[model samples]
Target: MTTPILLFLDINGVIDVEDTDVQGENLPQEYSTVYPVPGTKEFLQVIDSCSWIHPVWISTWGKQSQAWNKWAKTRCWPWAYPLDSDERHQALDLIGHGSDKYLAARWYSRDWQHRIVWIEDGFWLSSLYDSSMGAAVKWAENNSNVKLIDTAPTVK
Candidate 1:
């Protein structure tokens, strides 16, 4: 059997060109018109075909993740579970603004035995200032089970 792989996905620059930094905090309410990155369809297709890879949402959507879900539905993409718990989800500003995604994924997978694939645009956002961010980057680099894939704001 294939090993279970947790895919921690960030939507902003990973799946779409709408980087939170560029698009502002106010995301579009309607997703019907928004398009995804050029190769996103194929990428999603590979994830869909692989039963071992579990995709989880780790984007800036935070408490408003429902909006992301609505967007995913519009694109007919696979459902992505949130990495944040119900309590954390209630908190609006993520955990540490820039380092939230990386930190959350690290904390969430602490006890898990599954392999992890973290895809984020701002994975190293505060690495220089945040020790935890720097540590997380080091950990991902050294750990074979953890793979960090950085995406550009444009996704291509």
Candidate 2:
């Protein structure tokens, strides 16, 4: 049987929107905190119950991956994988004046390309909209993944 397809998650706008300074610019620090977005925990619970959903973090903040892992531990969010150094570099390299969606997309697993589903706040959607990987990216153009949720009370 084939392994489950990976679901790539973005932290800041997708999970939580905390203040962060990236290259002297203020941006969402999506990975440094443990608190989930409004319905994030519940959404994750559903993903956890599903055997086919392999959730993974795909954020620009490499420095916060460990912190995020620790946070995930409390919720048992199954954040086990870390992006490779090359992938990390690719993400960091995109930190510029504009959105980094395309740059982030480039860091996706080429081997498991279609498996990725980005959950970000549309920061870089337009730049990546026409890319071959656009459909894989989800969420509102101006909202965080967490904000897009309508709580289900519990994962069913």
Candidate 3:
């Protein structure tokens, strides 16, 4: 049997960018649109076809859909689902942020025996997963599971 790998998914820098959309009364009009990075469809296809990769959405949508609901209405992704609220909450309680992309995957993964890889873009890159400080260099030096993949720019 193939081992299941947990994929922590991020929406913003990974697959989306901001656009002007009404949030609600007295709120800012900013929302995310489908800004699929290069090879996005193929990447998701691999996840769908591969039995070992399990995708868990770790976006700002983890707590509330926010603009994701709108985006989802327009974008179809049958291959992915977010970590449930309880799991997301637990990860947040542990790491103190719902967007703790790296830590959340480690703390709430359904299977630890399987490998975990995160496809994300955020402050973590410079902070080493520090939501509040900068220690990324030191953290990367110490962590064994982190892997970086290079990708092409989105087509305009």
Candidate 3 regions with alpha-carbon error over 4 angstroms? 17-32, 63-99, 123-125, 128-143, 146-156
Tens digit of lDDT per residue, candidate 2, span 49-98? 66776666656654454354444343333332344667557656643222
Model 2 pairs in collision: 12-30, 13-144, 14-145
Which sections of candidate 1 miss by over 4 Å? 18-29, 63-98, 129-132, 153-156
Candidate numbers sorted by lDDT from highest down: 1, 3, 2
**lDDT scores for all predictions?**
0.61, 0.46, 0.49
lDDT of 1 by residue, 1-156 (tens): 999998887776677675334432333574343346665657766775778877766766554544654433433333233444663453324344324455577656656697999887755664656765676578788888998887743323
TM-score for predicted model 1 compared with the true structure: 0.63
TM-score of each: 0.63, 0.47, 0.53
Point to the candidate with the largest lDDT.
Answer: 1
Number of colliding residue pairs in each model: 0, 3, 1
lDDT-better candidate, 1 vs 2: 1
Candidate 2: TM-score? 0.47
Ranking, TM-score, top scorer first: 1, 3, 2
